[model samples]
Target: MESLTIRRPDDWHLHLRDGDMLRAVAPESRDMGRAIVMPNLVPPVVTHDDARAYRERIVAAGFARPLMTLYLTEGTNPDDVVSAHAAGTITAVKLYPAGATTNSASGVRSIEAVRAVLAAMEAAGVPLCLHGEVTDREIDIFDREARFLDDVLTPLRAAHPELKLTLEHVTTSEAVDWVRAHPGVGATITVQHLLANRNDMLAGGLRPHFYCLPILKRGRHQEALRAAATSGESAFFLGTDSAPHPTHAKEATCCAAGCFTAPIALACYAHVFEEEDALDRLESFASLNGPAHYGLPPNADTVTLTRGAALDLPPRIDTHGQSVTLFDPGHPLHWHIH
Candidate 1:
């Protein structure tokens, strides 16, 4: 098929940083209709008022409707979360195990420490979006996610059965299995992980841009993620986790972890689904499932994607004084959204 049309999709997870970075990247996601904006800023968005201000900035940057999330820290006030959700200023509360990723110094150090906030979110019908990785020094970096599933996530879920949970940018087969087995729980998959693996990072030399938290796994894990993403499972949907770092930050002595792909996210998804021979299921995965999980309606408009011709995406995006590199899928992408 040369062309395909589907409901306009929402990015279940995205990161448009503050200031010039936000201004530069927010516009790239305009076609995504809506996005659950991550709250891992410098100070982080931790309250209803903070989210409101951030939302205003996003609107100022030309993002039509950006869904907000509050960073879940140990000190996060339960009442604040309830108020934010009730007021509709934020859609969810994001949990980042301290030091899990960029701008996460204030993330929760222990699940027990944030029980009050979690309880409040549960009572308020607010979803909990997780980074899904652990920072235990004993655990190998690549093994953090699977270990987190066993060590933290399992117990957290058991304790808060009522809390709606979404494992964001899940990168392991173990995550796919657990999410699939649990009904009502959801997860988001990034296009970068769908196209690349750990080899892409270390196979030749260090490819810093390919490095991301819950670092990309091996081939089997990649296959599992691919299957879970294209299987048309409601538990799995789209989350670009399109984190951007300055060119210097990404190419430094110790590089920050993230892949900026907001510019070509849809095309990447189309390529993944089409390669899996599940093009018919793309709409459900990209558009319908996310809104259903979020208790929102799918977008009324549609986006048409054309295949049979390669779309030449720019290798990098200039955002203010810094430049962010775009993810290279390492294959010809024959799909383009129109």
Candidate 2:
């Protein structure tokens, strides 16, 4: 096929940072449809006011009605959930286990402290977006996500059966099974995990830009994610989680964890799905599934992508004295944006 058209896709989870970084990178994603912007800013988006202001900033930066998320804190006000939801400023509350990922030190130290907020969300019919990993130092890095499911999430789900939850950037087979087994739970599979395994980070040499939280897993897990996303399941969808960090920050001694995939996320996803022979189902995973899970309508606009064209993935985005490389800079995508 020369070209394919589908309903505009929304990024179910994204971290656009703030200020110059936000403005510099927002358009690439905006070229797609609405996105669920993460709330893990420096101070963390823990209040309705924070979410509202963040939404306003995103709009001011030229993003068309970006979906906003509240960063759940130990002392998050339950009333804020109602107010934010009522105002239509916050689509979901993000649960980040303290120190689970970037700027997550302000995340909930214990799930117990956020129970009231969760209850409010359940009552308000808002979804709970989760980072899904235990912060316990004893838990091996590779096993944290699975451990969180067994030790924390299982009980949390049982306790909050009414609450809607989404496991973000799920990388393991266990997460796939968990979402499949639970009717109320859904998930977003990131492009990076679907395309590469943990070994990709150190393949020919150490590649820091490929590093991300819930770091890439074994080939089996990569295959599992590919299957889940391309299966056209209503419970599975796309979330680029296209985190970007300054080049200096990423190339430093202890490089920050993130992948700058915004510039080429759709292209990469199209290539992967096409390779799997599931290109026909791309629209569901990219556009329809996420909105359905969140009880929103799919966007009316559409984007067309074409195959058999070469698209040059930028090596780096130079903004305000710093640069950020696009994720998977070495991979050649078979698809190109039209």
lDDT of candidate 1 over 1-338, digit per residue (tens): 67899999999999999899888888999669999999999889998899999999999987989999999988888998898899989999999999989999999998888998888888889999999999989899989999999999899899999899999998999999989877889999998899999998889798888889889999999999999999988898999999988878888999988998898889999988888999999999999999999999999999999886677778878857658888787778888787
Question: What lDDT does candidate 1 reach at residue 216?
Answer: 90
List ranges where model 1 is wrong by over 4 Å.
none
The whole-model lDDT of each prediction reads 0.90, 0.88
Model 2 agreement with the true structure over 78-171: per-residue lDDT tens digits: 9987899889988998999999999999988887888888888888888899999998898799999999999989999999999999999999
Total clashes, candidate 1? 0
Worst 10 residues of 1 by lDDT: 313-322
C-alpha TM-score for every candidate? 0.98, 0.98
Which lDDT value does model 2 have at 16?
Answer: 87
